[model samples]
Target: MEGIDAQRLEVKKERAPKLPVHIAKEVTKGRLLKHVEISEKSVLPTALDMYREKVDENLKGEIKTHDTSKLRHAEVVEKNVLPTSVDIAREKVPTLIVNFDTEKLKHVDPVVKIALPSVNDVVREQEEFKAGANEKGGMIHN
Candidate 1:
């Protein structure tokens, strides 16, 4: 310690442990600096701005009151429009007389008796017509 000069005293720095020769050889080489470029202007980190909108509301109302009063009125009128004389009219009508000869009318029959064909009779007549038409060789639509 006495042989060492004061100005020649050396200071030592702490270092991590050394890696094995095989691991050191396996490490890949990299570039010292990246290829990206930066501008002169810089941005600061700040909170975003909050915006608020204002709304206007309006209210209106109306009130009404009424007063009523009664009023009285009177009016009179006079006129001379009567006639001096008046005439009456009378009419005569003759009476009507009818004589009924029911005795002669009872002997004459106004309504004659008529017989209508029943369903069976009508069907039989249609069948006969069809047979006659077929014998006459005339074409009849169904």
Candidate 2:
């Protein structure tokens, strides 16, 4: 029995359709405006205006159920802790990375130590005893 052999086929390249010279020249020239003019005549402008109006209408009274006290609490939390948390996190990454550049490390180490608060450090204490009497009806012992 003789075996049949299949030959590989070569792919042919097709030429792209050419536009007319005049039309091509007009396209290359300023006939097509670079910046689109968005006017009432454009459907895009009308659609955009309608979308904005719908959004504004839907947003109305959305905050009516919101608790103002929660906002105050959030503000307090942010004021007391957010800045410190961010500063600590920022300082922590470099310390953990271990491959800091020499000069950058020198600068960072001191700043990190100073910027971050120690857990065991005492916050404040009384300076000295006051000899004067208390004004708010409390007994003053010298």
Candidate 3:
């Protein structure tokens, strides 16, 4: 094209897709931007956060790590907190026993509507399902 002017000769550069113009913003949209200092620092994505999120989401309560807190200036008790079964068996050292008065309860035998089978039956079942009764292998063949 010989008649084309200098202005026409210059190719128009396409605007870099205009970042796909986001119209609808979230409720917490500009709130995060207020906290971030764009000039001073480069803010990372929300996926890379400080808090370690629990992936498993345990239904049961949190597992206790430290049983007892290490007190700096707290009064330490010299006495044993918990007693062993042997200590419980012996009545020599009298301990604090909080017992509820069951005087209101009638001294009547509780009738079992559904009685569970005895431990003996469970043991018999275990014996039947023994891994190596015949000394064959860890697992029973039949």
The local distance difference test score of each candidate is 0.54, 0.57, 0.56
User: In model 2, where do residues sit more than 4 Å from their true spots?
Assistant: 1-45, 69-142
Query: TM-score of predicted model 1?
Result: 0.22
User: Model 1, range 8-120, lDDT digits (tens) per residue?
Assistant: 44321124356777665554333443467876987754443211111111111111222223335657678878553432111111221134445655466589889999999
TM-score of each: 0.22, 0.18, 0.18
By lDDT, the best candidate is 2
Residue 43 lDDT, candidate 3, scale 0-100: 82
Q: How accurate locally is residue 125 in candidate 2, as Cα lDDT from 0 to 100?
A: 18
Comparing candidate 1 with candidate 3, which one achieves the higher TM-score? 1
Q: Could you tell me which 10 consecutive residues in candidate 1 have the lowest summed lDDT? A: 53-62
Considering only N, C-alpha and C atoms within 3 Å, which residue pairs clash in candidate 3? none
Global fold similarity of model 3 (TM-score): 0.18
